[model samples]
Target chain A: MVCIMKFDNEKCGYCGACTSVCPNSSLELTENKLIIETDKCDDCKRCSIVCPLGAFLEVEGN
Target chain B: MKYDVIVVGGRIGGSVSSLFASKNDLDVLMIEKQPEIGVPLQCAEATSEETFQTIGIKPSNRYICSEIHGAELHSPDGNHFRMYPHNDEIGYILDRKVFDKSIAIQSAKAGTDIMVKTTVKDLIIREGKVKGVIAKHLGRTMEIEADLVIAADGVGSNVARMAGIDTLFGTKDIGSCVQYKMVGMDVDPNLMQIYFGNEIAPGGYVWIFPNEDGVTNVGVGIRNHKKTAYHYLNKFLSNFEATPVEMNIGGVPLSGTVDKTYTDGLLVVGDAAGHVDPLTGGGIHLTVICAKIAGEVAAEAIKGEDISAEFLKRYEERWNDKVGNVIKKSLKYRKVLDKLNDKELNALAKFMKGRDLDSITSASLLGLVKESPSLVRHLKDII
Candidate 1:
């Protein structure tokens, strides 16, 4: 089982805390957009843990 | 593969350590987890000209964004205190990516091998001694051996933890920070501003550092706050009409140094060792200072074939001799600042209204505490 990642555009302050903590380099903020490459994400939920804005949400799926 | 020194994390600390070691004719390897050396900049990027002079590096214009001579401090009640340097440039805003990469390039030229996109899984320890590391690079897990391993990895240092060092900092000791690179704002490009208040930043302060291109890094850092740093930053941004070009956030360990920075065959430097300023959250200068010591000591130890904890203690002793007292004093000041209410902050600002910048040293801070006898208790740690 894998976790589906959801990002709230309005809520994210784009601080890149999530990107910095993601062990797999699965998340990135480019041009003010938060990009999450699902294949590289290993369901660690580290992004959600470190995000100050709590913009990342992990849902069980796939 | 083997090397005389393996420096983890390719940022300023790791790169400088590698450079100094290689300059001493030691085989040094630097490994960075990121694909690129300095992408996703995580700093407010402000440092003094003295920092470069201390590191013995001539200032490069390639990455200097702005030169500053003064700063403005704002209290919660709209009181402001202005400070100016007596005779020289006091601060600078940096293009961190360019600055960091420039140092890395210099290290490479000094004969250091650098590997990017390599993630260190764990330390290779045999019989209570750190032997090397196991890392994954380009889909291959490889074991790299080194006589000495220098952990310059930032605050979330895996190397220190894997070595069984207690790197945990209390929540009150961590500063949560969020910053935005903004443009099209009406701000004095020459003055860095710091705002203080409970409503603005609970246990920390807000800063607006302007660059030469009219872009500004506006940010907030708070300690022991219930809300997230971005929440406060978003609220602060609501007051501005500027457009944000980029956003960066990270946690700074404001606690003093870790319990121990050196073990047999292993040394921790930079944020990994919690060398950041407790009051200002600045680490670049301290990182470079400590990394330089680490490099020199590691090179000498390897040369003498004595990479033992007792010998490595010199790195810690030299760094503490240079900056330990300042850090301790700052931590005492931070504790005093933490307990101050908005009214008292305004009062302190009022007292500082006419003070000259050069006169406001740590000793002067003690004098300020004397003015407010209530604050005298906090000086026990400082005095």
Candidate 2:
């Protein structure tokens, strides 16, 4: 299964809100970007729920 | 470069710790990952007058956008009450871009060195002790050594985690927040408005704090929910006629203070340490208090020539002695609050809407909880 979490950089405020709520600790916020550890994420959509900007979305994985 | 103390993240916690540490005669160096000292604001910027008093500076109008008089709280069913000040000053809405930088300036003026755009990529540990940091700036990586390290690195808290501390926040214990700095918002410029309901914010609340005339900071914070904070924020905004000037977003640790804020040669403060009120999700004041303690404790540890975990534990002890119980009590209260549904909240608000805000106490609040057996069970755990 592929990582189902999709990120839209344009909508990201880079505020680290998604990083704080990532239950799996799979999200990282570097100074310039928010990085996702897709393999570690369970596709829980916690990021989608907490993201204020809808930057994270769910997609069917190949 | 070597220093007596290295403070990571140059916001309130880092700057305050550096300020006090430098004043105590420590060679302090503060490193911020941002190119600017304060940019891309994440906070709602409402803080008390005590915050300024703690830092020994007058609250300047340059940074203070509006002086608040009191707060107005609204329940889902439209029942509301006002929280008036009992001889104490209310608070101020700050221009955080200016406010955060001013504090960093104060810390620098006190003889602390600062490097902006420098990120602490890793920590240098020797014999189970943190000795320094591996930092990156402009694609250049360098190692800076220090005797003691204070991690005020906000919610991401990579520095503290690198030093073997678990700064990760649970979904339930953290709040996902999104705020918009808005204009043409017709809110009372002197009152902070707070709305609560499960559908509105789930475990958190929404705020419409007036910044200046015709401008407001409208935001929403929700916890352990499937809906995004932005969705709720937009839903709330539909009730008002306002235009967004900028949108700010971040995570808040409402899990009470983190366990073990101190470990060999390293001390954690601010959001990284979970120095925020569990009930209100307010952190600036608590961060100010704990950061100062972290700084003073760091100075003492350096002077005592003991940078070990045992010595650094004093940082934890001192801060806990100051505001630890508040966080603990707030956590308990938050637990009880989280158990309350919209119906219970509406019922509680109905009973208190016309009562004197100053007359309400925990005992009286407990009496109100008696109306709902579900919350009473949780309330007993706190009482």
Candidate 3:
């Protein structure tokens, strides 16, 4: 299975909160952009929990 | 490009670091990732007179949006109280859009070169010592060398981690925050207001800081919740007749400073180093003070010709001497708040009403213990 998290770029505020709380070190946020390290993610919902705009969503990945 | 210092993330911490480093006659460069300094501000913009004094700058009328004389506290059960951090001292609600640029301008005037629209992709590390940074601006990359690198990159703190320091904050230590710059808020013009409840703010509180005239900053900071802070903030705004013109989202480190803020040729300050009041999540004063020390210590180390970690440790020592006790005490208070239930909060709020917040003593805790054993037991841990 691949990374099960999907980010809604259109809805994201790009605040970088998700990057700080990611226990697996799987998120990166630069200026006006957020990059998710999918390979390192462990399906942790921390990003979804803290995202101010509800931009992160869980999905079944192949 | 080479310089004596490269200050990353040009907010208050970066600008202050570059400003002081330049003032000490060191060639300094400050790099800000944002296209403009202070656009899309993440702070509630509240700070005290002590901040300006420590930076040795006069508070300009251009950035001072409102002067706060005191604060009002609210409990879940409708109990309320008023207090101030210091007696007979004024605070400020700033237009940070202007204040941040003003500090960057000051840094520039002090001979520190500034680069906007620049991002540090990685640090230059050799033999486990930070030598410089590989930065990119608008798709063009360059290796800029420096004797010292100060990481002031706010909460993410990616730069410090590149130097092999553990700056990753767990969810428990982070406060997910959202704020709106609102107009038509009907609140006391001179007093900032705080509302508390687990159901209301979950792990944090809601603040309605009145700006000059009718503008106010209404916000909420929540921790470790499934629902977002924006949801709680919107719920809180329903009671007030306000219109939001702008929104800001961010996180705060409330678990106090990281175990280490310095490494070989690298220093961390501001929110990156967790130089924030853990209880209040206010880093404005602490960041200014700590970043200034970082700059001075960097300059001192360079002048002494020892940029090693052993010599740079003085930054941590000096800052800890100045504000360590304050953060320690605030951490204890935050722990006490963490253990309280809504009933205990209401009881404590009622007991402390009309009493000076700073004057909570053993006698007061004893009086409170008589009412709620659980509440005072946790509060006693702080003593």
Candidate 2 C-alpha lDDT tens digits along B1-383: 89999999999999999999999999999999999877889899889988988888898989999989988999999888887787767789998889889999988999999999888888999899899999988899999999999999998587888898887677787788999999977778899999999989989999989987678899999987777888899998998877999888888889888778999989999999999989888888899988998899999989999999888887888889988999999988888888888988887677677677567687877767667666556556764
Better of 2 and 3 by TM-score: 3
Instruction: Write down the lDDT of every candidate, Cα atoms only.
Output: 0.81, 0.86, 0.89
Candidate 3 residues B18-88, lDDT tens each? 99999999999999999999888899899999899999999999999899988898999888998866668
Alpha-carbon runs more than 4 Å astray in model 3: A1-3, B358-367
| Docking quality level of the chain pair in candidate 2 | medium
> Who wins the DockQ comparison?
3
Model 2: how far residue A6 lies from native, Å: 2.3
lDDT of 3 by residue, A1-62 (tens): 76577889997888888887787777877889887788898887888877877798778788
Best-fitting candidate, scored by lDDT:
3
Q: Weakest 10 consecutive residues, lDDT, candidate 1 chain B?
A: B374-383
**How well does model 2 score by local distance difference test?**
0.86
Residue range A2-50, candidate 2, lDDT tens digits: 6577899888888876776666778878777887887888887767766
